[model samples]
Target: MLETIYTENAPKPIGPYAQAIKVGEFVYPAGQIGADPATGQLVEGSIKEQAKQALLNLSAVLEEAGSSLDQVVKTTCYLSTMENFQEFNEAFGEQFAGHEPARTCFAVQELPLKALCEIEVVAVVKK
Candidate 1:
């Protein structure tokens, strides 16, 4: 059975989708922007700040789904500008730390809320 994941610690989905969905041992987290859950506002700052918030948002979703960044097997990242790639990588790298997941990143024309970056993840949860 598939289960939807939700948490107050993460920003609510702005669209008609769950924050994450668990099926068997895997959890698929939706793409997260840099919106703060408490304020429901896009975090305002540099690309680094935005990337941090985005990772925090992803963390909350993974936690809610009974997984974590360490359990994450793969990730897809979207950036509004490739020029921010190094900055975004710096922030993202810190979050993942020693557990590096398979990842693909690309520059997009834009993201929801006009944010600098967004990330989606897939993780393995303890059964």
Candidate 2:
């Protein structure tokens, strides 16, 4: 069976979708941006700060789904510009630490809330 996951600790979806979903031993978290859970406002700052918040938001969603970044087997990241790739990856690496999950990143034309980056993960969880 599949289960939906959410938490007030993470930013609520601005659109019609759950923050994450769980099935069997896996959790798929929807892409997260730099919005704050308490205010629903995009965190204001550089790509580094926005990327940091996005990762934190993703972390909260995964936590609610009984998983963590360490368990993520794969991830997809979207960035607003290729120029900020290195800056985003530096912050991303700090968040993931040594647990580097297979990842794909792309420079997109735009993103929700005009966020600098958005990140989503596929993780293994103990169901």
Candidate 3:
């Protein structure tokens, strides 16, 4: 069965998309930027801080889908600029240190809310 996952703990979607979708034993969480849930605004700070917030947002979405970062099978990271890669890597690495999943990072032209970066995850859902 397929289910759409939504939680007020994560930032509301800015488009016509569910925060995440769970089908069978898998869940695909939409890309999440560093927007604060309470303010619904991009967090301020360096790329590391923004990246941390983005991952935190992603974690929240996964949890709502009955999954967690440790259950993630893959992830895609989008950076506004490659120059920020090193900093982003440091923070991202810290978050997924022992739970590293297949990952990819791309330097995108831009992201919603002028976010510094965005992150999306594909995870295995638990019963």
Candidate 4:
């Protein structure tokens, strides 16, 4: 069976999708943007700032699913442009820190709410 994850600390889904879903031993969080959960509006700032907020949002969803950054086994990141790659990487690195998870990043044409970046992760739920 699968369990849907939700948390007020993260932005509500802008579409018909759950924040994350848990199955068996893992949780898969949907891609997160820089939108503030309280306002449902994209945070105003540079890619670094936006990326940080995205990670923070991802964290909230993961925590709600009984997982965390430390337990993250893999990640997929999307950026609107490659121009901000360096700053985005720095922000992502800051969050992952010593426990870096396998990641795949790509530059996309556009994003929801005009967000500069979006992040998602797969993590092992705590037993």
lDDT of 1 at 2: 89
lDDT of 4 by residue, 7-126 (tens): 999999999999999999999899999999999999999998899999899999888888888999999999999999999999999988888899999999999999999998899997
Query: lDDT of all the models against the reference?
Result: 0.91, 0.91, 0.91, 0.92
Candidate 3: tens digits of C-alpha lDDT, residues 25-90: 999999999999899999999989889998899899999988888899998999999999999989
lDDT of 1: 0.91
Tens digits of per-residue lDDT for model 2 on 63-112?
A: 88888988999999999999999999899999999889999999989999
Measured with C-alpha atoms, the lDDT of residue 62 in candidate 3 is 91
Clashing residue pairs in all predictions, respectively, total: 0, 0, 0, 0
The Cα RMSD of model 1 versus the native structure comes to 0.9
Error of 2 at 57 (Å): 0.7
Q: Which regions of candidate 3 fall more than 4 Å away from where they truly are?
A: none
Q: Which stretches of candidate 4 lie over 4 Å from their true place?
A: none
